[model samples]
Target: MSAGHTAVTTPQPRPVPVEEPVIRCETPQDECGVRDLLDRLGDKWSVYVLVELAAGVLRFKELQRRIPGPVSQRMLTLTVRRLERDGLVSRTVYPTVPPQVEYELTEMGHSMTHLVKALSDWSIAHRPAISDARRAYDEAHPA
Candidate 1:
């Protein structure tokens, strides 16, 4: 209560109103094309195969080698089949003395290069955070 001091009231900031997210749960079957594509893209193996194919057309063996870890023959078969059916990948067979098969991205799949690349970039950037989380989980429950 100094004689020359004046009490000042600070203005309170208004809370930012969070607008509810518009969730369109109802979409006509016709508009489901992109949604279907997104489902395919979201698949773990599908995205891996797509990224590998982006380098160039690869033979089945090459794809198996390039992808890290061991993937079952059945899983690879199913993933490729799904991608092919979705028109995102193309499989070609060359009739040689010993038949050769190669998988390549179709025009539609090629269109997703930027999106996939962005995802790859994000993964690299966030790897430390992901690793830290894993370490924390392991520490919380020791074997």
Candidate 2:
């Protein structure tokens, strides 16, 4: 080693400790309530309807148009009714020769917009991976 040369040693990084997530235990009633809410939110049409309304108030036909894919009028009607019953949506009727009805998200429903959007974004982002997984599973199962 030359007297003028000095060896340099870099410090190693410390490992970060990850804290485990806390799992909360629910009572029977709480479980039932959660199950019921999940069932409603998990419905095929409910999330679509909520997403559509999240933009702004939309008429029945407008909502039907905004939502991607095919959705029956009857099914949309039922879905809106269920959302209304859950206090997640509000329906307003305009006074006119022919009444025009509009659907919008309530305060409670608006509160869920962030969660629904996050789920939607996640689903869209993972769609390719999910499709690949499905294809692989189907190929293996041969069904």
Which numbered prediction scores highest in TM-score against the true structure?
Answer: 2
- Which residue runs does candidate 2 get wrong by more than 4 Å? 1-33
TM-score to native of every candidate shown: 0.64, 0.70
Q: List ranges where model 1 is wrong by over 4 Å.
A: 1-35, 125-143
Query: 7-53, model 2: which lDDT tens digit per residue?
Result: 33445677898786454446555563557668778888999998889
Q: Residue 23 of candidate 1: its Cα lDDT?
A: 46
Best by lDDT: 2
Per-residue lDDT value at 43 in model 2: 84
Pairs in clash, predicted candidate 2: none
